[model samples]
Target: MIRTHQGINTDDDLKPDLTPLLDIIFIVMVFLLLTASVKLQSLDVDLPQTDTRTLQTTQADPITINLMSQSPYWALQGAAVEDWETFKTKLVEAVKAEPEKPVVIGADKTGSVENMLKLLAFLQQNNIKATQLLMEEEK
Candidate 1:
């Protein structure tokens, strides 16, 4: 024999109230939906359309930076840079000349992540926001 509250015996057990649990779950879901819709302000670039057949270039003459596989070596606008000082000097000059020009960074798979991040940080610090990362096509 099973005894319930108030000394009543029946073939039933007390079931938990799920209404409060469901209410908490609903509130959490709504909070997540609101936060997920917000867009972050950072380097924003138009990605290439995979399904489009036409080639589209946004800028007339984009400034390209090629980070070599080796460290302490890079090429800005086709000319080679041996050190960070030279690279920064050239970059500052370029940015001063064309403030609105878009920058395309071509980093090899073997390049150092630290160096790449440093370059990106420099760009962000100097207010050069429009930047693109060039990726190699996989075979």
Candidate 2:
């Protein structure tokens, strides 16, 4: 008479082969290295640092052009122009007199984009340069 016990092979069932996982990880590593090297080769020059002490000054206060939802406005030395015709006239005169003077545009967030485009076109037509967009700080 012999005593015999038959049981399931738990170790063989629980152990998973890691060769496929290692192969996938190696493929991913190789792909990333190739892409990173290619990207590094494309960069051209070093970026410049901001200078905090530089103070910007114009001969006079910058002429500000304001664009509202309904109409366009222009201001100079804290005085608003009467109408668009006057604004254009003043802009042409200023550009002709001193083209180096900077022009700042103050536009409301809800203003019409058409007005801004028109104003930009007018400036370009007159060869006016050195224009900047002005934005109010969030409170």
Candidate 3:
């Protein structure tokens, strides 16, 4: 009468209890949902007032300044300035003549950083704010 086989009950042993896992998953999901559903508070940001004039209208012709990689490391309008003193004097005069003109600076790839920084410092001291750096595109 005792014909119950214990070997046939392996299905129950092989089956793992997923109730705890499911409960943990549901709790995590509920937490995430609650956190996501919370109203986020943000302040009203002040928008900046931009200039209405176009570049062509305001900036007629940019004063191009080139920093060469060679001995004469400075050039204004394709003409190389002999020395730093000359370069500063010439640039100051040019800036004063056309204060609204934006200075476009283009540095040679092989140029030293020292020259570049010196030029920038000079421009800063002269209060030349409107400036642009020209970069050559790789061909």
lDDT at 62, model 2 = 56
Candidate 3, overall lDDT?
0.69
Name the lDDT value of residue 136 in candidate 1: 33
TM-score of each: 0.56, 0.48, 0.55
The worst-scoring run of ten residues by lDDT in candidate 1 lies at 38-47
* Sequence-dependent TM-score of model 2: 0.48
Candidate 1: residue 70 lDDT (0-100): 66
Give Cα-based local distance difference scores for all models: 0.69, 0.58, 0.69
Encode model 2's per-residue lDDT on 1-139: one tens digit a residue. Answer: 2323665446655679999999999999998766443111111112223344443333244555566554334454345566888878877886677666567666656666676788889878877764555543332
Worst 10 residues of 2 by lDDT: 38-47
**How many clashes does each candidate structure show, in the order listed?**
0, 0, 0
Task: State the displacement of the C-alpha of residue 26, model 2, in Å, after optimal TM-score superposition.
Answer: 60
lDDT (tens digit, per residue) of candidate 1 on 1-139: 7776888866555667789999999999998776554222222222223333443343546777777766545778767788998898898898789888777776766667788899889888888765566543332
Model 1: residues >4 Å from true position, as ranges?
Answer: 1-58
